[model samples]
Target: MSRNTFRQASLALSIATGLAALSLGAQAQVQEHSQAQRASAFSKAQGHIESFRGRSLSDADHSFEARDLVVDEDGAEHARFDRRYKGLKVLGGDLIVHSGRQGALQSLRQTLNRQLQIDTSPKLRAAEANRIALQQHGGELLSKQPELMIYARGDLPALAWDVRSFQTKADGTPSEMHIIVDAQNGRVLEAWDDIHTAAANGTGKTLYSGNVLLTTNSVSGGYELRDPSRGNTYTINMANRTSGGSILKDSDNSWGNNATSDSTSAATDAQFGTAVTWDYYKNVHGRMGIANDGKGAYNRVHYSRNYNNAYWSDSCFCMTYGDGDGTSLRPLVSLDVAGHEMTHGVTSRTANLTYSGESGGLNEATSDIFGTMVEFYAANANDSGDYLIGEKIMIGRSFMRSMIKPSADGASADCWYAGVGNLDVHYSSGVANHLFFILAEGTNSPLGASPTCVAGNTRVATGNASLSGIGRTAAAKIWYRALTTKMTSATNYAGARAATLAAAAELTATLGSDYSAQVAAAWSAVGVN
Candidate 1:
């Protein structure tokens, strides 16, 4: 199942009003303390449903299962519970209890509109719902019937069929689409991709990474470049077609000549990139695999004629890349590109940040952040670590986004604003990307090369105070912790700030107050306050 985040209450009224009325240092202290209290409550997570329902949700039915608990830095607690009625799961039925330092009930956040009441029996058959779902995704139907679910779409509850279906693309990249069909009316209420494909490199004298050893399979007649050592991560050639391209075969195990003229060279790069990325996540973060399942995802290179984009599909459980038009771009299989796409799989398995609004921006930024880290981890001479993304993709500029100065991309934002959530997720991601750069390297890095802030065209300092670097290691740890533990599916920038601050508090004991200070500064720099 994809990981999801729950919503939390915003900053208290008094705290929000005090920032403008209070002195600068005092305001920082107050905001820090308030954020700490919230984080503390979020971390403790020991709030009981009885206590929560008693004080805040008095009218709520007590049929609930405690799902998660969190305590903030000030020892406050926030408890999350899912409602179940008559042994059936209540869809969209969730409640959160906020408690003070002494475990006193403070507030509650509830998604249940009212006591649910609806007919459980369906007028439509499961087979009909299944057919409707298959039609919704435009994919071939499978034999299995849809599963019955108690669905609530922000209104009256009803029985629904959670239909699962799959779509195999012309290039053999597969994806699963899930549709929620009304059990009584068979209306398609909601549909989402079970496997997300959104847009990787390597080598044995490969196109990107040079002179690397490869693991292969000795097939019936020839050798295939399929690795058995690292979760069977292999590569195939799409043969410039949309579907059903045969796998590239080699007489000898040796592959590639560091050029795209030979398809094997591109495949070599894909294989090497996958290996390095897998090793980086495993060795550095100690994550067993993308999903922590020890299984490997494959790569499909040369997808379609002059296809400029690449995407990672969860349904196919692999990364698909396109060869550029040979003029504006080359193959999409660059090292950082591989890291970026694979991180999408990791995101899907973890927080599963919703692909809309601020959460969507966070999702994109997480991929960029981890992708950059992966590049840094590799430290390959062919593709050196840098803040620039897809530098090897384009011919002239050699960059997709610059984390240090996101505004340099022209479309990306440098700071948060009132309508930022409305911007494209790729552009909205600039805020977090800027914050990451400032946090890891600082405003004026020790190397004397740091990004300058801008309010449109005017230059400005990043935050209220001069910031210091916490280094990438500490910053990555805090981010990983927050993404995995503190964040949910619907978490936004405000929630992200809370989560990161909570992570900072947890890190203080081990990494020192300096690290925490820099984290706060970085967020403040990006106008997160």
Candidate 2:
């Protein structure tokens, strides 16, 4: 999804033979490509592949198989292809070729090393690898089968075993982590968490937002609190359980009381927030649903006894909100909170930004940005739109994070610095949050009683005069395009800068003024340059 332009070059075919073969398994079906498709693919991909590797792609030495052909709304086509060498899957060898409207090559993204040489034969047995993975994860084994595959880590490709096992942390949190063990020397290469949970610490006062419309269904017993318009989204009461929450049944569609004593009141807010978030994306960004697949996600309220946080899980395709300790915070079903959590689902489906490092920072900021946008779109009288995050939850605290001045939260940085990516994702998100505020409301400008660009947060001056906003509409559109079309898993602050600039260029193609310049100026204002 980056804007790295690829140059066309003539490619020559060369032959290389005698290599270990791969156990195709279920992926064998995708390896077959028709002659017509192969020719068309090669014609469009040759230039991109050569440009990315800075060498000619030999058909005899490598095999290219088309996996997915997608044409976006802008008429920009993206073709994903898998690479093979000597009948063996090139491990992480995958490339995405982007073509312009006229079918001309635009750019390419490759995950494999151009020159790969490694022994594919495993020395350690699969049983030993599984035992090692079990010891590392937890001592419990969930599945007995282990998959033997080539594990590629940046330029180093090695024969490895991918082992999966169940684990419970010291805090009693259930999880599953994939441990990649080197088959050659039996060394652990890497490990990653596969479990997705909305980790808030513990739900109900009254309905936070006032009376709002909800789409419900007429069931056999009574009207069910389900949204028919927005992917049939529904809310259930967990009754303080970790799983298997019961569906709430109401005699009438009207739910919630103005006060916390009623359990249904909290659900009123969760359901309303989901509906508003859905409308915001559809009405403003032309997105169909969370996954852009026209399907709704369910919500589980009252999750766990005294749980204090809310989260969106892609694994469950649902959102879970916790009832806060009544003395500290209210239910986590506030409008902005719902928007923030659901945005995680959107990020998961789109860029799938890695949940650590600089990309993780961007991932969190994306949620905050859209969450704020959803609030603005809602514009409810009781809970008006503002840049303040978690405003309703922290009761007396007023707000959690401020988009106008991210460092106001004490831990967040207002500007970027060297090694800034090493900070926590929540704190590192300040850089992007600051840039977005400047883009939407301008520095030194006042937005709805809240003055823009307060001096409390540390920021590098642009030397240029205060900015004039491109408006939230333009800002959101540019960001969405950058995220969905120009970002990769490893994209960092620099990559984000490039991606946003490219997005602005595409958006303001026919504009007289330079929109990309404003994008760069905003980034520089936050010390990104």
Which candidate leads in TM-score?
2
The C-alpha TM-scores of every prediction are 0.69, 0.77
Name model 1 segments beyond 4 Å from true. Answer: 1-203, 218-222, 446-465, 509-514
For candidate 2, the 10 contiguous residues with the lowest summed lDDT are 8-17
> In candidate 1, what are the lDDT values of residues 170-231, reduced to their tens digit?
53445566687888888887665544333211127687767776656556556666654455
- Tens digits of lDDT, candidate 2, 110-184: 545456665667798889999888776664666676677766544677778878777655433346666888888
lDDT of 1: 0.68
**Model 1: lowest-lDDT 10 consecutive positions:** 8-17
The root-mean-square deviation over C-alpha atoms between each candidate and the true structure, in angstroms, is 13.2, 12.7
